[model samples]
Target: MSTAAAHPAVRTRSLGDRRRRTLAWVGVSLLVVLGVFVAGGVAGDAASTTALADRNLGPSAGHPFGTDPLGRDLLARVLAGLRLSLVVGTTAALVSAVIALVLASAAAVFGGVVDRVVSWLVDLFLALPHLVLLILLAFVFGGGTQAAVLAVALTHWPTLTRVLRGRAREIVTSDHVTVSRQLGHGRGWIARHHLAGHLTGHFLVGAVLLFPHAILHEAALSFLGLGVDPGEPSIGVLLAESMRYLSAGAWWLAVLPGLCLLVVVKLVDTIGENTRALLDPRSAHL
Candidate 1:
């Protein structure tokens, strides 16, 4: 049938399908960009070497992203930094999601006092400023990769835990869950077979959505000298070091790295939104 002549539901489904396809293509393009950065980081060794003679050069065939004041290739440094940021962000998000799953599941399966305590903790964390809390945690851990990861992981969990807890509560009241309970199925059995299995998609989407936040926070921490070591090639560190050279009119030093970070964050966010929509049943007719 012609699109205009089709039923409203059919048209809606078609539109949603097209949107999902477009989003899938965009996600693939983003992945390709990320892969290129990873490959460049692996292939480029010029980031570590300082060529004083070539310092502060603008973009060219020889130095596409130009050279920093320290004479390190900006392109290479950006790629390396991008890779590190992605690694740290993904690791932290995954850790956060896992913690959320465990705590949320426990609260749902073992209700009453446990649920109240978990819910209270979630509310408390949600009320606190994430960045400030993250910085404090990072500082306590002495400000390195471990500190950044831990801070991001710990700080990001409360929101996702609340979501999972709500879903778990709904599942607990389902007829199959009631039947399973009557059949002598323990909480552990229902959790493993029903709750965990059903909640996997939510967990995955939550983790993906958390990635950009983790990356930005990691970069912010590093920029403030509370994240990665100064010697490490991270996007935040590169931007932090670039401040001194910007006054000398070497704009590429800061601009390029900043753009790269922005692109990565935007792509991750887009992918997360797309994934969430795809997983959501309501979006089927959008």
Candidate 2:
């Protein structure tokens, strides 16, 4: 082939390779996260088991993440924390996504009053300081796992709602959707068959993207004593408890677990980004 023809083939191959790598990274990141979630659950009791003899041990072959002041295995504790974080984050994200979906759908389909209300609500939420709003809601809800989930869910929906509303509005105006409306389809039927079907990609991508934020917020709430139960070794709780010991040179107490949390968050965020790229027709081929 001529150089020009060969250049196109090479570019196509490069794009294909890049796409595959992105998909692979997404899959691997997901598996690692899922593994941590499941492993932590399996090691539930071990995370809290105190071992006076092993107290404050640094990273060793047997205790890779070291031991906490209370002599609990740090790795086990971190795993448990991650599991709890995952549960809280996933629940909150799903709830937030559902809220977004419902409000966006209403705004797009009903328009006028409903649209105005949604727009106002989204603006109000966006205007608030996110973390402050979270803390306030969490405090009001009595500061527990449920509170954390609810607060995160309530606070995170506005952005997604706005995005989905725009998409939903476009979908509502599409030929098929208009035809459905003209064919005697009820609002509910049209929503389910047309809007919902079309908006699935946006819904999923938004939910996935919301997860890391949920996890971090949950951790922050716990750190502030407004998150999971005090006794649970959630990442935030672990970090909270490690504060006193940090001055004593046991850096692993806070650093290691915090790093793990960051890693998980990064992984989840990567998965979300890659998934979004794959789903987006604009970028999927590039």
Candidate 3:
């Protein structure tokens, strides 16, 4: 082949290689996060134990993440907090994705008034400030894990719903879909056999992308005292409690947990983005 022809092949190979590397990184990040959660769960009450002698200690050989004002191991506390945060975030994301999928699929498959109503709701929700709405909802729900999850689930669906709705509409109007209808396939049959399969990729990508948002929002709500209960060791709660001690030189209490949360969110976002790129037909060949 000529150099011009070879150039495209080389570019394609480079893109594929980059995607593979991204996938590897995503796997490693997920494993690390999971390990933290597992370790935290296993640690149980160990995270909350206090040893006044170690109070206010900074990072050192024995205490890598240091100790809080109450002398609890910051490392253990952070791990536990991370585990709770991940659980809340994952639950909320799953709930939000399910809501989006149902609304989007119904709107696209049924069309007319259903589509109009869903579209209007999406626009209305999108217009509101997400964090404020989440906080309000969390407060109303009584401020706990359920409240936090519900708040995140309710507020995060609009954008994903819009995306799913568009994709579903396209799928329903495609040649194969029309032929299936012409062949006497019922709506339920067509949905089960055609729409579901076609839209799975979109749903997965949207759900993955929603994970980071859910985590961040949950942490914010907890930090604001409208999320998890005060006694719960969630990332937000950890950060909120650390504020009072910060002025007294317990900086590690907040910094370590905050950094861990940030890293987890970034990793999830990266994984979602790369997954979406890999799944896109147009990008797959490139």
Candidate 4:
């Protein structure tokens, strides 16, 4: 009767085995881009982006992706921004994911007094709109990369908590989980070996989905001047700077960088979807 006693690893394997090879390739592409960003950041310069005369120029050998009104090298800024996005996005999502997992696991596994409290907190957060909460959070946390990360973490954790709670509840009733408990497994052991089997994929999938949202949330705050500081080359900051020049002559400053941000989010989303498909084999059929 207790799924919590189940052999979660076996179930997880069954779930994963149904996925096709395409999912692996998609994952690899994401890793490759991540590597390029890390390598490029070490070699790139945020401040060295070109000047006024060179600003707003179209693609050329000397300057690819053209220049912004401030004459900053759009390509270079993009590369540098990529690094910032990757770091900020990953850290924010991971921090939130951990919090969500902890809170949700506690609620689901315990399920009496603690469950009500955590469920209420999760509901309270969900009741508020994400952007409104993020901005308010950004202000309270104070503006910077930390604020952006904290704001995103605060906003993101609730959904993951709910999902984890749901999975925990289901796993609790599963046959393998019940058997595991009867076999004299400790709570920690059950949670780690069994519950973890059913939940890790969910958490990982949620984390991947969280990545694009993290990037977008950071960019949104930066766009509104509440995100990463101006000196840094964030996509949002770049777009904000480009706004003034767009009226004068340059369009690429905002457009190209925006496109780059857009593409990154899109790619992340695709990866998330593929991961979801891999985890949920019925989706592969659909």
Candidate 5:
């Protein structure tokens, strides 16, 4: 059946399927993320599949990606890393979005000293290098999973807030909004009834787009030793470890996890594209 002719649920599922496939890449990423912590806490510490005897061995049923110099199971490590990466990625994205929404909404609805203060803070954040600032914050704050999550989120909110603030500005000028004001509607009513409806689409699309950034930020931080701590199996951290084994001919240590990260980013980009097509009036025909 034609994509357009399929049942609505099926069509939605199709989109979901694509989204899931894309997210599968994220699943792999999260494995690396989880591996660090999971491996540290597991039995025999066998999380990494590559045994000492099997170090640098090529892909096989017993050791698909082969072992690293440290004799950890690379496959297990990669899987675990996926969980960690996802946790950090998802955590950063959610917290960042919440922060952006609260600040943006308050600034837009109140529009006084609050707006200026928030806008100024946003400008300050925007001026800093996001990844660098995140690393510094993570370093200063602490090294727990939650700390890493907050660090990433704090650095991320400025861009989203800027986007949403602009969107709200556009919405506040509309006729319905103006009429709501004239009709003696309260600030809450104007925000909930008129402003929110229009901004939802834009913000959601922005949120999806932010996913890849969040993932990358978390992975990067972990790699830099500022996010997930040692033994925390993030893909970025794994990639960092793999670099050590690269000179010894253990390629899968990096390749598999890196491939997963790349694919997730692309898939997220695709979803954002499709979402754009669906949400943008100008792109609806496409």
Candidate 6:
């Protein structure tokens, strides 16, 4: 290679090209998510419409994912399920993230008694039986979309809280924070200006990573008949309904929808991981 091309700045410029490509991939993934949401929304009513005469069909040109025993189009139903999962997961993840951020910030900023209380709460939540807790919460809330969202939201925050708390504590003890305090800023002022601002990226990345877990939990509750109403063709509901027919040798009823769910989850996970990588100074070069 030429001396100019071998220069450190030139190598860094090539790395920038890789970073741009990573960004492009993220954009494409987001577009795919948007397309699924839109398609599902468009198929909302059709997802519930049934034609018994056309029931139990396998994949074909007309119905790409085939038809359920109720003869509702599986493709449409899966799309609708995905759309619903996206909504529930996104809402739950955001709520959970906020809860984590607040508790972590409080624990870090106010230390002593406040820190102890937050630590106790985080430990208590972390020690519980996660799936059982989800079921209990969903059951308590009367088992529907709202219940499922609440159950997932409430259960997923502890781990993230612990992570953010450590980061927040580091920030709190930093020279900049010390300087702000010496300038006569109150705890609230320092937290609002210094702590909150620095932690925004971490908060966002945590929320995105939490999304797949939220989606899966929502589906699990739905599969157990405590999620979205049975009238809604959620992936869980579809899988639940497919159980009986699998014995009758209707394999597509479960396989295709399940695969679709897996794919969507994996795609969201990829987005989160890449976003984190790009945001982390240590990983930005990769």
Model 4 — which ten-residue stretch has the worst lDDT? 40-49
Tens digit of per-residue lDDT, candidate 3, span 68-114: 87888888888888888888988999899999999998998889999
Residue-wise C-alpha lDDT for candidate 1, range 168-286, written one tens digit per residue: 99999899999999999999999999998889999999998899999999999999999988888888999999899888898998899999899888888877777777778565357
- Against the true structure, what is each candidate's TM-score? 0.92, 0.95, 0.94, 0.86, 0.78, 0.95
Which pairs clash in model 2? none
- Residues 85-200, candidate 5: write the lDDT tens digits: 65677778877887888788888888889889989999999999877788788888886577688887888889889988888877777787788899899889888887778878
What does the lDDT read for residue 65 in candidate 6?
Answer: 94
Give the Cα-based TM-score of candidate 1 against the true structure.
0.92
Give the number of the best model, judged by lDDT: 2
lDDT of 4 by residue, 54-98 (tens): 656877787778876667777888878877887899899999998
Clashing pairs in 3: none
Q: State the local distance difference test value for candidate 5.
A: 0.74
Ten contiguous residues with the weakest lDDT in model 6: 277-286
| Alpha-carbon RMSD, each predicted model | 2.4, 1.8, 1.9, 6.9, 6.2, 1.8
**Candidate 2's TM-score:** 0.95
Candidate 3 TM-score, true structure as reference: 0.94
Total backbone collisions, model 3: 0
Name the runs in model 6 displaced over 4 angstroms.
1-7, 283-286
Badly placed stretches (over 4 Å) of model 4 are: 1-21, 24-28, 46-53, 179-186, 284-286
Q: How many clashing pairs in candidate 2?
A: 0
Model 5 spans with C-alpha error above 4 angstroms? 1-50, 281-286
| C-alpha lDDT values of all predictions | 0.89, 0.94, 0.89, 0.82, 0.74, 0.93
